[model samples]
Target: MYSRKKGFISRSSRISCTTNEVTGRYSSGHSEDNSNETSNRYLSFRGFFRTAHGSSKLFLGCQNFSSLVGTKSGIEIDSDLDDGFSELEGPTVTGGMLETNVETELVEDDVDGEDVEMPHDKLELSDSESDARKAQVPEELLKAITTAPVQSLDKVMVNWVEKGNDLTRADITIIMFYLRKRHMYWRALQFSEWLELKKQLIFTERDYASHVDLIAKVHSVQKAESYIEKLPKSFRSEAVYRSLLGHCTSKGYTKKAEEIFNKMRDLGFPVTSFACGHLLTLYKQTDKKKIADVLLLMEKENIQQTEFTYRICIDAKGQSNDIAGMEQIFETMKADGMEPKMITKSNMAKHYIFAGLVEKAENVLKQMEGEMHLACRYLLPHYAALKKADDVRRIWQLCEPNARIVECMAAIEAFGNLHKIEEAEAVFDKMSKEGKNITSKHYYPLLRIYASHNMLAKGKDLVKRMSERGCAVGPLACDGLIRLYIKAGEVEKADSILQKAAERRFVKPKVVSYLAMMEEYSKRGDVHNSEKIFYQMRQAGYVRRIRQFRLLIQAYINAKAPCYGIAERMKADDVFPNRTLANMLSKSDPFRKTEASELLLYC
Candidate 1:
């Protein structure tokens, strides 16, 4: 409806303003009025005074937690987050959050003191800013793109770069930002072409190395290497080579990485920590003769070796029956006044354990304490595959009170290989009494053990503990919880867990989660949620999953809902969801019940 006398028109959409052609003033509108078309994640972050939200470390460092806006002032911190992760622990990163807050202000209104369209643009890109009362898009993209789906922006970027008419230096930077974000690897080849057109393009040495890092962040290790190749001779610095070499190693390009090591020597770039780590990782994954040849090559090239050079020998001989060689290297390292790293010592211990010299391994474990204790804590589980609980306990005692959660969890996990369920539970029970809150770290392992032991109720209790402790329930625990629900014939509880997994974007709602949910809907014949997820599975791009589809179809049948041709459609497609879902379908399909029915009948 509109006022006809003044010829006024209706205003709509969220944060959308109507422009007056004559005055150029924004027609004021309702912020509350919004539709799904404009419900951007970043926009909602700003509607809450973008400054406060940006400056808060929790929201900045956190992932997928922007949905917490609707909740009251309460944060359910996962034990696995900063609190539990002692390795990356330091003072809470409030400063980064604070900087984000400032960035948020820049978003709401431009620095020039003018109103922009919506609150979503701040999180979007802009080329530059200064103290002014005018807001402009600058005809360029922003850096550090935090968009949800970089894939969605492919068409936009392809059009902009191909035309090359509507662009600025900042625009190119935005291009790099998006390219790196989306890992649009093909775009780099285009960039190389643009560089040829205008010898000096947007990338300078100062930021080129960083751009390489950005590419690595997006998992474009090969692209990162390619960019290094294109860097001009004058601009090709040591920092550039180091970044490329690091990327090569990360991407498992062993041959290219070795070549980079030689190039670094030729360029006379200092062999920093990065160079050592990369070269050593490559040599470790290769043969002993190859590693020896690499060392000789380094010597011939006049490139001095770093302490990590010895790691090659350690990796080669460690955890194997090569006891004599490891002993000789340890003796040489001591004689050379180059302290054998704890890794070397731990590797020696691994050899002892492999050789079944339990007493010698125990002596080595005793001798290795303090910081080295942490390294050995990780090693003990591998060696303890053949040893006893006392050996594991001895190593655990050597570890600092704040040993890595992975290391601690490893000790608990090693129990299964030894068939030590009660002992494993005993450690968990002791940790509980000590008030050491077991999180997802312990949750999955304990759940698996319980399920294997037929202690379904206990597994469910562990999941409940995980939920209450604010531990993120992962797929493993979800499986255990569903199994418990099935054993007790509590299909409803199982379905609820499956639905929870689907809501949180768990990669694949395994047969456990899917089956339990389907069974619940089958027992009650409830097809509403079942069909919704069937569509959700398609929306999530898992439609070929026959198991998931069949679950929905069978649930519909049980509920007397209709899914008449779904079975044929599934088989017409890939006709398989996953193993578990496929099994369920095989059992329930009356027409082709060969696999599932045979298993059911025989079992």
Candidate 2:
């Protein structure tokens, strides 16, 4: 038997276990007259115990308390209830109260049992947890992770994970990809190391290669080597070695690159064309002999040479001025059913240019018309050097179809230099009509052309338009305007313009503007003003070049003002007078002609 005491269930002494059936119900064998009284006593004890214990359920061994107290008349009391019935009943109740308490405790236990089963139901999910992983990482999360401080990265990742965000292998890979693309290699390495230590991610060969490459780029080659050494032997494959070799070659770590290349060879890894090409390019300038060796090895090993292989070999030969060697390689390249790219054709043109065969260079450029736009900026200067102004114009026209801002600017400058003012103005107008952002660079050439032609009003109008359009007239255009005023013999006007430009802060005058003023003052034999302008240029932090010293020395010598000291001053400023300046000084001052001639030897 069980009885409640101080909110706890305790075993009681044996009680009566008698049953009496009435109307298909079982109950304790009590008199009908006392039935009502006993029922009342039982109900009162049950209510009191419930209020005292605050628990409606109790377990006594394997028997349920509610089963002992059957429904109303069906109640069956234990046979040994008399042992401690008095204690449970107290003064106002009978054994029925003990039975009711047991029944109530059992009811509470059943209700509590239902609560224990709830957790098991929650354990089953509708789908795989991994299936919830996103294909692409969230941009906001990526931005947060990337912008977070290096030390806080772990915390950021942890917080993101704790927020129920699923991070998959693909998501991790995307993060590393962006980090590497942005050259945030150190951060990528840190992320990779964290993933590795956590062991939550399974890294593939590509992932490992990214890590190794980041190590090489962000840390040192020695660390990269250590990382490779620590990698599982299965991960150290040809692709991994090739990635390392490529990094070494790019960084000019020749010895380390060679070691990696040889290690691959000794391990019997197949020599790929990319690997051979990288080594060839690295040694092109420093060691052509190695390039020859690599070419021979490629043939011996039955390795196929791609167009890139031919290009590197050709570049190698060109660097050595081996024009015939380059030509031979070019023929081999064609025989291999490979069409030369712009870079290949450019190399051939370079070879011809080196040999002074301008006609052959022009022919190569003609063949390269489809790709000439990319090379026109450099090619135009070469043509200008050869006195081929028509060729320069032809190249400019060829480049116009796909010309960007830089190409357009280059065309205008080229035309200005060649004195083709109409062509320069036409290009400028086209650029303006196309709505390309016109910066100060676009204004320089046209302003110089107008200034050189003595069209002062037109230049001033252009400056006004520039200001109206919110484009400040920069130092280059201002220098051109000042030079124009100087050329027109409007010295006072030029000085006023310089002062106004300084006052307005539209453009800070550069050394060129001061040099222009000095040249004008020198041409007028105003040595005092020229010297004063030179000193002003110095105060403005202009490092005096040889040309500035030459101009000032000539002006001083022209005025015959202690000109011998100019040579010593030139030496003091580390601006040695060249042959032309020495001759000018010797002729201008015969008294110091011997000293100037002897100083020329030292220079």
Worst 10 residues of 1 by lDDT: 67-76
TM-score of each: 0.43, 0.45
Could you tally the backbone clashes for each prediction?
10, 16
Model 1 C-alpha lDDT per residue in residues 1-603, reported as the tens digit of each score: 012221211123111111222112111211221223232322211111111123321111110101000100100111122222111123332323322211110111010111111111111123352211143433343332222132334444455567775555555555544443333333433453444455535555545665565455344556777767777787777766666666555433454666676666666776454465565454343222234334433433455444455544544545224454456445545554677767566656766876787878767766665555456554566546655766666665665265655555566666655667776676566555454544443566666667556676677566555545544444445556665665666666555555555543213333334544555565566778777656654553333433456567667557654455565677675343444555655545556645675899877
lDDT of each: 0.46, 0.56
**Model 2 off-target regions past 4 Å?**
1-142, 159-182, 198-201, 371-603
Top model number, TM-score? 2
